[model samples]
Target: MSRWSSSLWIPIVAVAILIGSILTGGRADSDPQGRPVVVYAHPPCPPDLMRYFEEAFADFRQSHPEINLQVLHITGNYEDKIKVMFAGKVAPDVIFMYPTALPAWVELGALRPLNDLLGTNVADYFAAGVRT
Candidate 1:
């Protein structure tokens, strides 16, 4: 699979965890009424995969009726757009990006460390992905 294809699960898993946390009142940063979680994904996805993403979102919505979720699919120049969003302090809660960009985002404090959010379950992620 292409790197992007493999990386797709990262956002899905993150979303699942976020929804779970919200449902159980495990995420302190989230409001009791549940805050909207904005997700940003890049293009180049196959039609079938896009369908899967939609299905996942639908399931999430059904399971967590109180949570507001928004997905933005970025087309050309995704990195630049993400940078602009960060500059405007409108970065999405979930971001799909190339691993190479992680360091810069981390340095800029645009990304949160997921160790606490993910806990030991993070070991399930690929070593390279964990590193990223």
Candidate 2:
């Protein structure tokens, strides 16, 4: 089995959130080489959830101001979007997805490993919220 097939979605989300946070001004100072991070969300999130998410993203940006971020809204099948994104090599630096979809991505090496970022015990993450 390949290394990526070992299940490492945490790093993907971490990188995505990190990149998202940076672009939104979470970190005040950053290097010029930092690349812009793109974020995608299914359109029509509940208004209350959208408000909460905006606040959360705002908090994240405040901590990483140096990174750039773009939030794209999608209106079609989530899997289809993911398929095209990966196939076209335009996958976002981070994405929020259902747990069932991860194994396939792991097998495809479509995500980065969290071991290098959060170290071991990454699996200790709670199943609620981000872990799912």
Off by over 4 Å in 1: 1-35, 119-132
Which ten-residue region of model 2 has the weakest summed lDDT? 22-31
Write the residue-wise lDDT of candidate 2 on 14-122 in tens digits.
Answer: 9998677656654323246665554654444777878987787788778767665556666667667876777655566677767788898888888776545555766
lDDT per residue (tens digit) for residues 10-106 in model 1? 9999999867765654324344576655454555577888999889889998997777666778877887888876775556778886777878888
For all candidates in order, the CA lDDT equals: 0.73, 0.66
Clashes of 1: 0
How many pairs of residues collide in model 2?
13
TM-scores for every candidate against the unseen true structure? 0.57, 0.57
Give candidate 2 regions above 4 Å deviation: 1-44, 119-132
